[model samples]
Target chain A: MAAVALKNQLNAHIASMFAAGFLDKQFQELQILQDDGSSPGFVSEVVGLFIDDAEKITGLIAGLLDQPVVDFDKVDALVHQLKGSSASVGAQRVKLSCEQFHSYYEAKNRDGCVMALALLRNEFYDSRSKFQTMFQLEQQIEACS
Target chain B: MDRRRIRVLLVEDEEIHRVVARAVLRAAGVEVEEVENGAEAVRRVRESGAGGGSGAYNLIFTDKQMPVMDGHEATRQIRAMGVATPIVAVSSDSLPPDVQAFITAGANDFTPKPLTKEKLGHILAKFGLA
Candidate 1:
């Protein structure tokens, strides 16, 4: 596709993500930084970091949950870190899921925590796919531009 | 005082936050030095001296959550050393209580994170560094 068309496609796709509540203004802030030459590939770099960090945290949560004596404090702290990471990258859905996960862990409700983790995982995977798609679109635009 | 570009120390564990904040600060013509946590922040302040010297920072920006030490403790420690350099707490966790805690711990100001050029400009202006 031509650069303009690809750019438009990217914008529309990003708009859809925002409309779906998968992203927020902070993501746009990142894009602005990228555009201003503050940091080339800023968005992709941050998104990549978020994905790597979230994956590790998710695995840690799963391991903690599987332990016979679950350490709710540790789980909560990990979830909090995940939430902060999500917020940093403007991963709204994942951040919201992490917030929901908080109440469950806070109450020391193992069942609730398990259920919330499933939801959190689903949201995170969905957000990750969306980000990946955006990255591809950006790459296409860059290639043609 | 000295005629030099404003210098700021950025304390944030998250790499992305550090990247964004450094970009914004550098764009504003401010010199930035970064550390991943508060203990390093304290050490940097101590080693460089906070008294408007040749290598001292004019300001400090720190996140609330970190591994070795939190912003509150770092701010308190820096203050304890009698370094009056302005410390601004930059965080996403900006509840009233959190802001109050930062102030009580000796932060000169508080700003929400995903630090923007405008927000940073306001901070610099507030501290007369702009």
Candidate 2:
């Protein structure tokens, strides 16, 4: 009964993510891939990787922005990578933020880039929190099972 | 198609992409080898091509944006060495211009990033490996 409740909660949370546009079809694809039995815990593994990579990229971006002479090329490259990473995991909001970041990056507008980075950071953290919640629910369900 | 198992060389700088792609390919029973960047990919292709078929891969999937060397240059170098293996560009950029650029760079095919089993299947069938 407890596991059943946890499972339902997890499903609801996931549905809310999609409904809110925090995730997209790519996340469903990841679930399908995990279900294939080719790799157990694949979703969790990917979420973990995404978080680590996002953190590192954002840190790099922040550092670059702090420099008196900003290297727009390097910043753009990092953001591009972050966008790719977010897309792979279906972090829709974060990916969009990265795309917006690119425009400012292209213009070499440091202020705009800073604002974009903040937006990206917010999306990344929100998505990361949701993922963590999902993981916890999964763990509880597994324990009940 | 030969009865031998399909082998693929995956050239990607990102670890998450590598993990995802490798899982998909392995699920389809395809053998996979990974390299981090285009330069390493070039070296791997060269070495395998020189190994007299023992280490040769049937297909190569390369990400277009990477450090050290990008996929376009890698594809160009591989083609220059006269390698006949099917080279597929796997990238997030899938627009017409992107596709044209990949083809211009000598890629045999273009598949967008976040590769799915179906997409990979089509690639295999298209290349006569399926």
Candidate 3:
């Protein structure tokens, strides 16, 4: 019964994310790929990597911004990487945030870039929390099964 | 078009992407060899020679923005070595300029990232490998 409850909660949380535009069809594609491998926790594993990558990249971006002379190109490169990584995982909001971040850097708008960074950071944390919760629920289901 | 005999070299820096690509390709009965960056890709290709010979790859899929060496530079170097294997650019950025850059650098084709089986099948068939 507990397992069933956890499963239901997982389903609801996923639906909420999808409905909120935090995820897209690409997430489903990742899930499908999970079945093609021996590792059943493939999606969770990838999600975990995405979070770690985001943290590192965002930290770098923050450090770059704090410098006296912001090297926009370096920050843009990081944003581009984060964009691709987020897209790969179907993190819709984070990818969109990266795009906005890139645009500000391109325009050489320091203040705008700072704002975009905040947006991207917030989206990353939100998605990270959701992913962890979803993975924990999945682990419960696996154990009970 | 014997899938089992088809060999590919996949160059991507990100671990998750590499894992996904390997699983997807293997499931389709295609043999895949992976490398982390374009420099390794160049070394691997040179080591194998060309024309899908015993140890050579039949095709190449390289990510655009990798450390050590980017995909464009790698493609140019491979072409310079006269390795005529079809090199396809695999990236998330499909902008015209991005696509043009890879092509100018010697990639025969371009495929957007977050690779799907359908997309992979289409690319393989286009190259007469499927």
- Strongest candidate by lDDT: 2
**Could you report the Cα RMSD, in angstroms, for every candidate shown?**
2.2, 2.0, 1.9
- Every model's DockQ, to 2 decimals? 0.53, 0.70, 0.59
Tell me how far the alpha carbon of residue A23 in candidate 2 is from the true structure, in angstroms, after superposition: 1.0
Better of 2 and 3 by lDDT: 2
Chain A TM-scores, one per candidate?
0.96, 0.98, 0.95
Supply the global lDDT for candidate 3: 0.87
The models' CA-based lDDT, in order, is 0.87, 0.90, 0.87
Q: Candidate 2 docking category?
A: medium
Please report the interface RMSD of model 1 to 1 decimal: 1.7
lDDT of 2 by residue, A17-69 (tens): 99999999989888888888656699888888889999999999999999999
Q: What is the lDDT of residue B99 in candidate 3?
A: 99
Error of 3 at B90 (Å): 1.0
Q: Is candidate 1 or candidate 2 better by TM-score?
A: 2
Better of 1 and 2 by DockQ: 2
RMSD of 1: 2.2
TM-score of chain B of 3: 0.92
Q: Candidate 3 chain A: worst 10 consecutive residues by lDDT?
A: A33-42
